[model samples]
Target: MDNLALIESFGDFKDEKGISKIDLMAIIEDSLKTLLRKRYDSDDHFDVIVNPDKGDFQIFLNKMIVEDEMSEDDDLEIELSEAKKIDESFEVGEEYTQEILVSQLGRRSVLTLKQILSTKLQEYNNAALYDEFHDKIGEIVVGEVHHIRNKHVILLDDEGNEFILPKENQIPSDYFKKGESIRSIVESVDFHGSKPQIILSRTSPVFLEKLLELEIPEIQDGTIILKKVVRIPGEKAKIAVDAYDDRIDPVGACVGVKGSRIHGVVRELKNENIDVIQWSKNPEIMVKRALGNVTVNKIEINEETKYALVYTPVEEISRVIGKQGQNIRLATWLSGYEIDVYREKREDDDVNIDEFRDEIEDWVIDEFKKVGLLTARSIVDKDTDVLAKLVDLEDETIDDVKQILKAELDI
Candidate 1:
């Protein structure tokens, strides 16, 4: 261990930046300290020292000096004549350095050192990434759209790390232009591959909640609480809000004076529809409200099953069900119940057996054309009650079949 050889073993620490010898000494000392701790189980015996000028590191195993004839375990005995050769005052209890060879370490020990250095470097990188994004959670960050696959939008964040915005987590109608910058809140950070993975999202309910918190001071101040939110991304969202403080109106605060506050959140969601509703402790009231403006005649709930059967006017059925069942689906999700919608039957529109039979019979006869039974008149004229006898149908079934045939034949 000459100084020059030890320094060269560290590769080049100086290039354009030109690191000083002291820096190399510190690095080597720290490296050796970690290596000794990992390699040896002893507590207070081993010590490491680095000399900048010599570019070398030294390891010392502390031992007490003793007389050559002493039988004490605490001392490494040397004759008095031999001790005076090194120094005149070299006492019997003094400690001495014993040079260690790096080559004396086994292959595993070298591997352990390499692993320690790699792990430390990775940890340093991870720490740097954490420092960069720790303060950015819940805040919007812009990322470039790299590619879209399996409904997941792959985005490159500001740090050049790829983040995934799962398709189900993205607003359906929100299209990302290739290479275009998309803005979304940093939903979460996960450490992966020596760096913090930044997860971004636009369709998360938290995004709306955060947007409200930003726009409405009442929410941020803790007066207003978001009770529940149901969203059909890029289509519509229903938010139920309540105020802990009586002085604050949660819905009104979120809606602004004339829809200003909520409109801001909607705009940020790419102009998605937002309905701000006052939260209610009553399940019926909350469910009715969750169904939006659709009028419910009555709500019958099976508590055990958590199912709600809502009766509404026939015209309002479509309203409650929404387009393609979005309304009912959102209502169910928000209300945490299975919902079955029922519409009241009009008085004049009561089902008549003859009319029903006629309608069905007409369909059957029309269908029978493909099977060569084209006319209800021909079927009804049969003597053995052809439908009941031939098809072995019950009386009611035969009668229904006759009516369907007649209706189908327009007879």
Candidate 2:
């Protein structure tokens, strides 16, 4: 069983691939046992063992020594007279071990074992790759852009692992060039085929969180805490942060001097707007702050519905809504509420428009306010037919609703 060369050869090969000796030996021994049973007798009992120092293995057959000198089956049954030549102490009808050599194992069996070991090594390497990167999900990695496909960029990470940066995960404003550096968060890891699949992203909210952790030393050291972050990807994001120490301003820290700290993140995001909001336990205050520069005169909330009605000045409406509602969209995501920003308006007759919130449909309420019909008196005093046409309601529908308002107003 002195197979030092065989073991040394495998050891050298596996060492280069970072495979452990125990794992390789298990694969080799298992393959040999399968080969031995397949090519030999199905009833054969055997055990395989490898000498660690010599790097050699032996296949020993457990067979009985019978006194039947006429028995022709030497593979499983050995005659006592013949067995005595090898061992003088051998007894009749007793089981003994026979060491089979590699030559006796046959060329076909050895070749099959080689193929099995090769396949097992590939599987081992794939599993090793998976184990190495599975914990890196959500962490940032620096990579060099190796190649760009139709919808993905192949990046070689710092550890020399190839990660897939799909177009969907990347910001729309980002462009890829070969040999350029790429920084992104690890979104996922999978051993799809021969290699581990690492998916990277630059647009995920987690990426923004990582960037904040990177740019702000206080956040990393825990002086400042990021309560929550939500992004609309390439357009805008809202991040709620708070300072544990009153002396330290979390919002100011994140914004940096002259917009320096935030500028790093903004440049990385292709100039995407990031509103570092002062996190508040009160949902009303948080919702108002999430609107960024928009000044909120008042905030009304329905806790059960998680809906916020924000009243800002008429000039601040566009800022609250942002371009194409992106600001409001991200604000809603960050504040955990459905926010509807409104401008405060009073009827010329000093009518209370807030009372009509329940009377008219939510959509038509804005049109009525826009037309200066800010009160029940305004709606009821106006011609009901003309109101139906103006608000796109049927005459009966308008009359039925307005009658209730008229009776309440005692008109």
Candidate 3:
């Protein structure tokens, strides 16, 4: 291409990529200077003046005039005989200035200039993308699914910026088709070489936090503060929220009437069950609230070990633990404590070991039965070490047996 065509081509690229004109000019000048150095060995004696708006540039080379045979480097010192051809009065020991046309750079140098400019512009774009997304971490975004792969899904924003939703970062129940609109949080931004990898996550706790902020004006306006969020992705999630004002019920406000406000967030997360609870400074109340809003009869906390033993009514035990123990697991994470649930014993109720024959091993039940610990409560009430000594079983086995008994009897 001619000089003007080349510059105009750069201008077209700049406009298409949404690059600033000043940045494009800087890249162009640097590219040209790089080519000058490659062709002339050094660009120190070259003056490059560029006018990107006018789509043109000027290059002038300066060399000291020397005797024809005495010229050591043609790039820095031109022979006097050659200088005299351009101007007869030209003499040795003086500097000679000559204009270098872009066309004179030849086809190979022009192609090299294009390559350098394209590389620089691409690097600039990647850096800009990284910076923009880095600052936006933990913020939610919606993008169209452009491609789905085994390990990750590629999403494109309105402006066509690519984001990656890795399989591990997606909710367990999440499934997306090409061209589907997906909403997620910008979890992280990193560089794999010069390419910026913008990672989006649908399973992050921050994703739920951001969704709550978007859906609830109380949260967005700072009237309610989201204290913490913990999740099992598509299975269950728990968020602790607090409000400074006594009149405002943070949990009820977030849940809305008949679960109106949080419905959208739940649907977006593939119907992940969310439990919103009021945060409290008292660890016992916090632990009780974290346990899926269950009515705990008692809570014994060991602050140094960050562990708690919660006793709830027998009927509330299943709800406290949830399906597959997800609720209690989330409560443990949210409360910063290792929680063990116990059923509040009643004098009238006791499940015989034979009643748990379906859940406990025959050999395990026989071992407990032999010790006269026929009732499920009898096994649960004893410590692991004491039970192990009485039942001729390992502490782990005794513990497992206790768990099975407790689970079956709703403890």
Candidate 4:
């Protein structure tokens, strides 16, 4: 191939499947640069020279000028006679270029080059993917539902690239229709081989926050700050917001006049229920607000461990915990605290509790207190055998505690 043909081949470096030539050349250059960098530990010192005339690619490695060809193993050293071959006026201490053919590479050398190229290209693609989605992390991207696999909804972007929306990432009430356009946040971007894979989500609390930011001008303008969000996907979400500007009510701004702003967001989210509450710095208040629609009688918070003991009416326990403990789980995640629910002991239930009066109550209570279990409610919730092991109690004492707990707590 002539020089022009060789350069044109690089320019037309497309695969038979119609991949871009420039992209292929970039992949090749990236591959070569990685290999040379690792082998020489200097990426900038090597120049890749592609000669179309000789159908060869040469790596012009610049070595330091050395005096006297004393080291026989130095391939960089050129004897005065050998130096004269390329240039008759060649000096003893000058760097030179040696032409090498790609075709002359052995099987092992070829394999090494292939591996280096593949690895570098993958790394480059991953970095590119991260850069592409990092700026768009809070923004929504529209995609078409393509197919379903292993309970995950596969979606296609505008470029026809496929992305996996895992089952856990999808909103509960939102059913995806084939070829239907769905909106979601670019939760994350990962690189696999030569392409980028985007992770999409609708159930993330961040999705609701982003939607509010999109709909509410006050939030986008920094007058209102979204502090925390606890969500049960399509079922319900509780958002805690604060007002940076005293004149603006954060909750009022999110609700909009006649509830327009939040309604728009709710509509987009398939009419998922939302409760906007004023954010409080107090851990007790924050935990109470996180358990939305549930009336909390009292809350005791431990600042050191970030745990809360919450007491609620017996009827509200299921509502606070939600189906499959989703509400409590989301509340804990959003509030950054562990919450244990308890109901107050009733006076009428004391008759049943009196049956186990004499059996090891003081010993179990002392052991429980030593191990940080300060409440009778916390002790009654534990499994008798595990609690016995934790407190180093005899099996007979554990059995007595279990009966007492079963009678008192109705467990």
Error of 4 at 172 (Å): 3.1
lDDT of 3 by residue, 1-411 (tens): 677788887777788889977777787888889888888877999998888677577888889999989988876899989999989999899889988877787988888888998998998899988999999999999999999999999999998999999999999888899999999999999998889999999988999999999999999999999999999999889999999899999999999999999999999899998989999889998998898657888899999999999987766766777776788899999999999977775766776666555566789889888879978788888888788788877888888888887766666
Give the root-mean-square deviation of each candidate in angstroms: 9.6, 6.9, 5.9, 10.7
lDDT of 2 by residue, 133-181 (tens): 7888899999999999989999996667788999999998988889999
> What TM-score does each of the candidates earn?
0.61, 0.77, 0.81, 0.60
lDDT of 1 by residue, 224-303 (tens): 88888878778888888898877777888888878987777787788888878888877788789889888899998777
Instruction: Judging by TM-score against the true structure, name the best candidate.
Output: 3
Best-fitting candidate, measured by lDDT?
3
Model 2 accuracy (lDDT, Cα): 0.80
Candidate 4 lDDT, 60-161, residue by residue in tens: 655433445553535345566666766777776677666434333345555666677556655655665568686787678888989977778899987666
Q: Model 3 scores what on Cα lDDT?
A: 0.87
* Local distance difference test values of all predictions, in order: 0.69, 0.80, 0.87, 0.70
User: Stretches of candidate 3 above 4 Å error?
Assistant: 52-55, 81-94, 312-317, 342-411
Error of 4 at 228 (Å): 1.0
Off by over 4 Å in 2: 34-44, 51-56, 66-81, 88-93, 346-411
Which residue pairs in candidate 1 collide? 3-54, 65-92, 360-404, 361-403, 361-404, 361-405, 362-404, 362-407, 362-408
Instruction: List the lowest-lDDT window of 10 residues for candidate 3.
Output: 351-360
